[model samples]
Target: MWLILNIVVVFWMLIGVLCLQVPPSEFWPAGFVAFSLPVPLVLNFLFLIYWALRRSWLLVLPFAGLILGWTYYARLFAINLGQEIPKEAKTLQVLSFNTHIFNAYDGKQRTASGVSEEMVDWIATHPADVFCLQEFYNNRNTGGYNTAKRIGVRHNKEMYFSIGEFGRKYGDIGIAIFSKHPIIDKGAIHFTKKESINRGVWADIVLEGDTIRIYAVHLQSMSIRAADIENTYSAIGNEESFKKESRNLARRLKRGFIARAVQVEQLLEHVRKSPYPVIVCGDFNDIPFSYTYNQLAAELQNSFVQAGNGIGSTYNGILPFLRIDNQFHSEGLKAYNYETHYEMGLSDHFPISATYVLEPKPEEER
Candidate 1:
């Protein structure tokens, strides 16, 4: 009994430590759940120990833990939770993704992976009204068959592409927006990027007898390297050496923090200037709490949080745990269906898709 009690307490301590790594943004619903899912299990173990120790009153520890957990995230939950239910209207679905720099992924390395085919198949299964793709590539011509054109042709939908860094030796990154709706006016925003990032794409799409603007972007990556992430592991081999390595990581994160802030600000300016209600989706490449996600998700609400039942992480290929891919929309649009295409098996980033119903335009302002 004494041993069991000690073990359960140790479990709580470990779980508490795990909660510290997630960004402050998900600290609400998604972050809270990530931080709290182990509580119930830990408490169950404690309950059994209490039974043996004859300390029935000790159950209060578990109860208190629950309260603490909720209290920690209550404000974030409240601020984000919807109060006025969105009215129903014809729903239009969209999918967006950044295909990464290689134009190929799916564990295949540099080999020519069938990413285009797989993407088309995935879209056929999901059936989005609009589709957006980033990190685009052309075939043998260095500008041959684009992934967007193929997908659009497969569905017989109009493909709208606003190119960025095109006709360069290796800087062909661009945004592709495809829609069943008639694409009216299309434009692209060129974001300041030292990393050669593709700029944001905007298209006025006609849907369900109404037109709404959709902007898809692949913001400046945090410029974090795989070595930096791997170095985060405990300094197993050489404590002093690992400490020095980790310090370098901290410095890199700081630089990245500043760059990401500037990029998010630029992106937000574009979002705020949209002439019509908008749906914004992309691989933000930053965590929920950082200035990138905070600035981008300011007024625009997250679709995965609004409608997705579980933690809807879109960067599926790299690590199944992080939720960097996101969808945000204006108040008039309600994300009815939200999903992460976790099984596409191509691209380091997973695709995020959502179906939204547009409410009647608000009478107050433009």
Candidate 2:
């Protein structure tokens, strides 16, 4: 019985490993399956402990599973002991946050909120060279708060946005880049998929001696409606409603997975054509183990996996364990001192920041 159970557990872990390689388009279930990558790791650890307590050599099964799935585990969590902070001349601090429209729109109702003011104040205190915001609202004078302008003024940086299709109805809905450096060039990649938030924007900023292209992207969200969420929590224990909400949530997740896959292909193409060194940051709206994340990770270095320690979860929703927000950079740059600024809970997502520096060119190149 023990052998049979352990074998099943090991096989499940292997399936999780396969999820890393399989694209969502090839097998849609893989998209949903990848989210449970951490589960197998935790279960294997517990099984290893169970076998060890019994002084059984069968512990090798779960141990080998851990060894095999180590890369996925490493991506989820890191322990950095000797990570050092960069010096003033070398350091470039960048921040990425999804403001969730400052929590201003609740369903059909749109009312003013102090969330934007508080976020501006927060940014003022914890300064960064560049601020990349998704679901940014910019309503000047009409709704009483122009978030982008306010943040730009507070930080004294120029702001660029990928204005959404909704236009100014809910405040220029889109992604924005606020940079302290002088932006020489800027553009936006308007996604074909019709999502209000799915868009990418880039700004070429002139630093000390080189140009750095910063991309602010907001991928397809899991379009789980407020009613779906509220029903999930409020109507718990009611089996019929619970199952209905769960199904809707799952459908949204699957759609988001496929949509993000398409969006990432566009993002990768844009990254490939970049003339300057690149730093891409934003709310991915997906987990670390998903196909969307793996595609991006293949092209660039992930800042959190490089410099962050422990579980660097950034999403502040019911399941706060999801690190949907990420920071990635091109090969020419190095990221250090990555952190999730959980101090201000003004939005559904937490802000993440990282200090980066240009890698010294090889002697022959110079």
Candidate 3:
């Protein structure tokens, strides 16, 4: 019986590793299994310790499973002692956050008057040179709700707001990029699906003498609200209700996975063709184990994996393990002091920031 259970656990571990390579487009069930990756990974580690203590050869099985999915493990956890940035280093501080529309609406109604203002104030005071915000709100007619104007005016930075169809009908709300440096060129990457409020916006900013591209992206969301999660928990005793809630949750997640796969492909094409070194930042809305992350990580270096410590979970919802936000940069840049701002829990997602310095050009290129 023990041996049978060991085989089953090993098989589950294998599925998690395979999910990274096979996208949801090819096999939709892979999307559902991706979220369970961390569970199997932890179980395998425990099994290894158990077998080792018993002096059993079964330890090799769990050990092999760990090695097979080592990359996923590395991406999920970091243990850096933290590096010091030189005072004279020409560093560019960049922040990426999902503002959840500045927490303006609680369900159908507007939140308290000062709620959004408090969030905006925290962002304005942050010392980041570049801010890439997702689910950003800006109301042109209303002076108090003009978030873009408030932040840009306070920091004296240039702003680019990518207002979508939803934002146009309802007061403006979408993704935005605010830069302290001069924005030389700017554009938006619209997904093939016209209805998606999610977007990718890019800017070419002249930093000192060199030009660098910054891509601020917000991908397709799972659409799982806090109420939906609460309902799932509440229906635990009733099997029928539990099944209904679970299916609804699964359907939302599956749709998000499929949509984000197509969106990431579109964004990658634009990223590969960039003329300047690029730093991509935003709320990915998918974990590091998913296809969205692997595709981007292939082309760029993940800031958290390089410089951050611990799990670096960025989601501020009931689901504590989701590190769906990220910052990825091209080889021409070096990342330092990557951090997730957990204390400022004003939105559904915590803001993540990192400091970067341009790599020196080769003598021939100079």
Best by TM-score: 3
- Local lDDT at 1 for model 3: 66
Q: TM-score: which is higher, 1 or 2?
A: 2
Q: Give the TM-score of candidate 2.
A: 0.91
Question: Model 3, 1-366: lDDT tens per residue?
Answer: 665666788899787767867778778898878767888888878888988999999899889988987877888898767488766556789999999888777668643343478889899889999999998887765777778888997679999888874443346667899999999999999986574558899999988888899999999898998889999999999999999999999999999999899889999999999999999999889999888998999889999998899999999988887899999999889899999999889898999999998876797247
- In order, the Cα lDDT scores of the candidates are 0.64, 0.82, 0.86
Residue 252 error, candidate 1, Å: 3.0
* Ranking of all predicted structures according to TM-score, beginning with the best and ending with the worst: 3, 2, 1
Pairs in clash, predicted candidate 1:
none
Question: Could you give the candidate ranking by lDDT, starting with the highest?
Answer: 3, 2, 1
**In model 2, how large is the Cα lDDT of residue 254?**
87
Which lDDT value does model 1 have at 363?
A: 68
- Model 3: lDDT equals 0.86
* Candidate 3 colliding pairs: none
User: Per-residue lDDT for 1-366 in model 1, tens only?
Assistant: 754665565465445435434333334223333334444445544565665477676556555554555522221222333334355557888888776643543354443344365555565456788887777653433333345545677678887766664553333446778888899888877765333554778899887668889988876665656666677665548889788877786666555555555656677788788878899887777655445665565678878767765556566443455677788898778876677777774677888887888876656335
Q: Where does candidate 1 stray beyond 4 Å?
A: 1-88, 101-116, 140-145, 168-171, 193-195, 231-235, 317-320, 361-366
As a TM-score, model 3 comes out at 0.93
Kindly list the per-residue Cα lDDT of model 2 for residues 87-205, writing each as its tens digit.
55456899998888877677567655544677766765567998898888777755347676667875688988777845445556688888888999999887784556688899999
Off by over 4 Å in 3: 1-3, 86-88, 110-115, 165-170, 193-195, 364-366
